[model samples]
Target: MANLDIKIREAELADLELILAFISEKSEFDGVPHLLEATADKLKQTLLFVESPLVRVLLAEVGDTAVGFAMFYASYSSLLAQPCLWLDDLFLQSHFRGMGVGTALLKSLARIAESTNCGRMEWTVNTGNVPGIAFYQKQGARILENIRLCRIDGDAINLLAGQ
Candidate 1:
């Protein structure tokens, strides 16, 4: 891994174009068109959501290029009675891996959480993603065992629309 001169900074509207491009490019590798689910208009709404703290995006810049990014939202757990940062998406281009870009991005999130007095930082990585799981372990993040995630997206609701 080369010495990555990475700068971690909060993203701005000007970053939307690059973010969209990176998201579009990465979907090809993951075989997911998830970005298609987030049009520009939706992103605008996310940044302005009043019910929740606005989703924040952080860009990892290497020299003059943005090689990675992360998007996250904040939430509070009534049971825990504390706030948490829910990481939604994290991506680093293949060429930038093994150079600490991911770690830097994660650290930035931790800083945000600490500065905001958050209680936890959490995210879910696919089980089939062995490398990602290992990386989280390396970062001292333990998996929450015995917990399953249930999701209801547009498709599910669309199917039950007539019911």
Candidate 2:
């Protein structure tokens, strides 16, 4: 941590291009490049102009250089009747990995969760991503073996909604 001067800040509309580049790199790194469909227009619409926005983004910079980003949103746990800070994505450039960037990002997210009175902060790691799993575990996160994530999107999502 001493070797790098890292600062975490909320992303602004002016940082749209930088944020999109990070998202693309992250998608490729995670082996899901095909899933990345984010555009500057969409980001602007959802993150900048939307009223009562459901998502927020954070950027991590190392001495004026943007190295990573984290996108998150709030969720509610019906069973616990408490809010949760859901980390949708956390990614740092390959060169920045193992240099405390990921840890700093998680710490920042934890701070946000605590400040918001969230019951918990949750995120998912790919099963094949050993290093990511290890990093989360190091931060005292538990892997829910019993839980499986499901998703409906694209055509299915619209069809189900009678679109």
Candidate 3:
């Protein structure tokens, strides 16, 4: 049980494949592999090539091996009149779980939020993921039971737009 020196850093364009692999692994872990439609081209265009990427990614590695990633985006809270950091995804390899990698990633995100003067940081977790919920609770995140997530995408978006 040697100490693992985990290093967290902002993702670079060269790490595209590694990021995509982590994303696919996360989707599979969430039991929705079929819903993972992300391609390298899409990731490159949306996350790397954009002038001002709405979404940013952070990678966690132990030495030369990548072990986890956290994807997040900036959001606005009209009521608070301040920016918010919305964590889109946080995933660590199964072997790396409970090894402080997740905590390291979260602490990094918190630092970023504080540095940017964000009003809040938010993300959703599946109710079925008890371990994940517990881990998040340990990290001082409150699980909001009253709020429900809403989404409209794919064909539904077109219909909503009256297209």
- Candidate 1 residue 121 Cα shift, in angstroms, is 0.7
Best by TM-score: 3
lDDT of 1 by residue, 10-82 (tens): 8887787788777776676566775466666667666633355478889999998999889898889888899
**Which residue pairs come into collision in candidate 2?**
none
How high is the lDDT of residue 30 in model 2? 88
Q: What are the TM-scores, per candidate, against the unseen true structure?
A: 0.87, 0.94, 0.97
lDDT for predicted candidate 2 compared with the true structure: 0.90
Candidate of highest lDDT: 3
> What number of clashing residue pairs does each candidate have, in the order they appear?
0, 0, 0
Quote the RMSD, in angstroms, for model 2.
1.4
Give candidate 2's TM-score.
0.94
Q: Please give, for residues 40-96, the per-residue lDDT of candidate 3 as tens digits.
A: 999988894589886899999988899999999999999999999999999999899
Candidates by lDDT, descending order: 3, 2, 1
**How many backbone overlaps does candidate 3 show?**
0
